[model samples]
Target: MNEKRMLDDQHFEQMIEEESICTTDNKVYEAPLDALYDTAMHYCPGCGHGVVHRILAEVIEEMGIIKDIIGVAPVGCSVLAYNYLNIDMSEAAHGRASAAATGIKRVLPEKYVFSYQGDGDLAAIGTGETIHTCNRGENILILFINNGIYGMTGGQMAPTTLPGMKSTTSPFGRDVETMGAPLKITDLVAQLPGTAYVTRQSVHKPGNVRKTKKAIQKALEYQKNGDGGTCFVEVVSNCPSNWKMTPVQSNKWMEENMLPFYPLGDLKKPNGKEK
Candidate 1:
């Protein structure tokens, strides 16, 4: 074959190989974790909240804990999570999801209870409830969605909002001189004696999605094993509309800005194992 033709063929072969890997990865759904419902989510395109929702649903289905699971939905975009998830759910006042979940779990210790909360709700108004629940070692899962802004409430500033980040309330960027620094709930709660598992994960990419699912599954497993401790999963999500950015830009911002402030990994785990 001519040298030019050989180069062309090599290029074609590399393209084919790349395509194959992409196809295989797309098809490789974590068998043990599959969504129970269809893909018609209420969230906007490129919303990390939707991805986390799907992951939790898949985990619950895989573990066969749907019937025994009770979820407490907090104020914010995820307040409507009950509309998508096909399980028993209760709505909680802003930032009081953990308290509500604690009450329910105490009444029904055999049931698997979980709370879905947003950054504003979990870190600000609901901070007290969350802290006490974790400190008391409530046997419940806390799926904390930190999008860094009040998504449902017109893009207001949240306790987890990054320094110098612009929001509706902080139009000129959040000033630490007045607004204070972003709250790192995962690190704070992990220090509590009642915390059994504390992980910070994201759904910004496919690999991160898989890791987030595993973290959630581990939290549920810990609860099933009679480990009466707080299992917290802080998902650094995105709010494209609230942030006034396109979906792609929102994702890029999460990787560049959010990751720096809230680094992802298993912050605290049982047996003192490193993640």
Candidate 2:
């Protein structure tokens, strides 16, 4: 009886030690108090950009890289994303964020460089720049927000627009006969040998938000390692204002339609694990 009681006490002590270690790790990962946007954002209630912004902010704060980070903002609804993020940022001309980021990183290699681009910009106009940058192994993080439509340009059909998806330009739904299939940017970019990490995630739900944060952190950590390669994150975001649907409906569309077309999770990791 005494031996059994002693065994139970040992098990209890081991549980306590494990709990303490987990608590310490959680504290270490706690986000900074000043790591969020200062003002109320104008994004719609169900807009995925807000969730992405918050996750980026938290990752920046948790990693303590804000002081050394430089963000390049692309043109679109996220044009004003620079104003919201409390970090050093530069605005690039429409669809030229990767080029701008390339220049910045070349001049300031020590800084953590990143470019935030949209589907229309990255998969369409800036396709050449995006491909070359990744191919050349530019040490930059490319946060590609693929909402499947051109939000700023009145819901036009973008390169990432899925089949049967309707946009302002495709009022009758995207026709694979002429419009072509949706461009899976992450999958395409992952094929580039120079790319160190490539992942696709969404922010339509709470569980996804957590996963998105980890993905962002992985990209940032890859940059920190001076990987000398591209880290691409294709985020499946929502545009309620342009989609002609309520915020909730927009999120539902993302889950019901978007996920099947642009499935989430890591497409490639050079090291075979999160950085």
Candidate 3:
């Protein structure tokens, strides 16, 4: 069984590296390979949460460890991830997903544990837990969805909110003087020795989506191979509904505004993990 699992993982790695999906000449579409149940997502139009979820599910399925995964969700737009992701899931109080995930990992150390969180829940209220968990070198994956504004709480300014960006709470442009600059928490966490990998990415385009998947897949493989540290994947996404722009406009705004501040790239990579 172990040898078969190893072979399966190798097959997946090769398939992922090919960078293209092959199919028949006829265009017969099917639901995503990892859609465990027939349920629709509740995300607003152009929201990146659903795509991120699907990517995680795909990686989990490819790794052949679907049953061995445990997902922790925080109180934000993706609070109901358990519904869409047909896996063992638990919900944490607002900004407490990291804490809950810590306990879950400690108890069920054998399972592939991860926490799905939003910028508001992770960078602001749960800053302490986020720091401590990474500081302690917890062996888990942190999937942080950083969409500058608080999408779940009616477009409030999040800790990651870019300067000159407006939200319900900040009608005028964000005053960096008063609010402080947008927090690059990913960089801050990378400074800690306990963190093994830190990469900021986006799923706004097809090529970016593929890179994001590779980032996640690499992070998971690193974790599985006794890299005793935290793997943080910060996804800089867009909030179209809160921004009051169409999906296309919102994406363009992100490229113009958000990318300038939260540039997408790997901030840190541990020794021997860079490939």
Question: Evaluated with TM-score, which candidate comes out highest?
Answer: 3
How far residue 214's Cα lies from its native spot in candidate 1, in Å, is 0.4
Write model 3 residue lDDT over 1-275, tens digit each, in one string.
88776787778888867974555554464345663456778999888988898888878888888888898999989999998888899999999898899999899888888899999899999999999999988888999999998998899999998888899888997899998888889989988888888899999998988899898988888778746588899999999999999999999988998888898999878652442
Candidate 1, 1-275: lDDT as tens digits: 69666687779788878766656557756432333455476777788878888888888888888888999999988888887788899999998999999999999999999999998899999999999999999989999999999988789999998999999999999999999998898899998889899999999888999899999999999988866498999999899998889999999988999998899998888754435
lDDT of 3 at 145: 95
**Local distance difference test, candidate 1:** 0.88
Task: Tell me each candidate's TM-score.
Answer: 0.86, 0.85, 0.87
Tell me which of candidates 1 and 3 scores higher on TM-score: 3
Model 1 ranges off by over 4 Å: 1-39, 272-275
Which ten residues in a row are the worst by lDDT in model 1?
30-39
Please give the lDDT score at residue 80 for candidate 3: 94
Highest lDDT against the true fold, candidate: 1
Models ranked on TM-score? 3, 1, 2
lDDT (Cα, tens digit) per residue for candidate 2, span 77-170: 8898877898899999988999999999999999999999999889999999999999988999999998889988788999988898898898
lDDT of each: 0.88, 0.87, 0.87
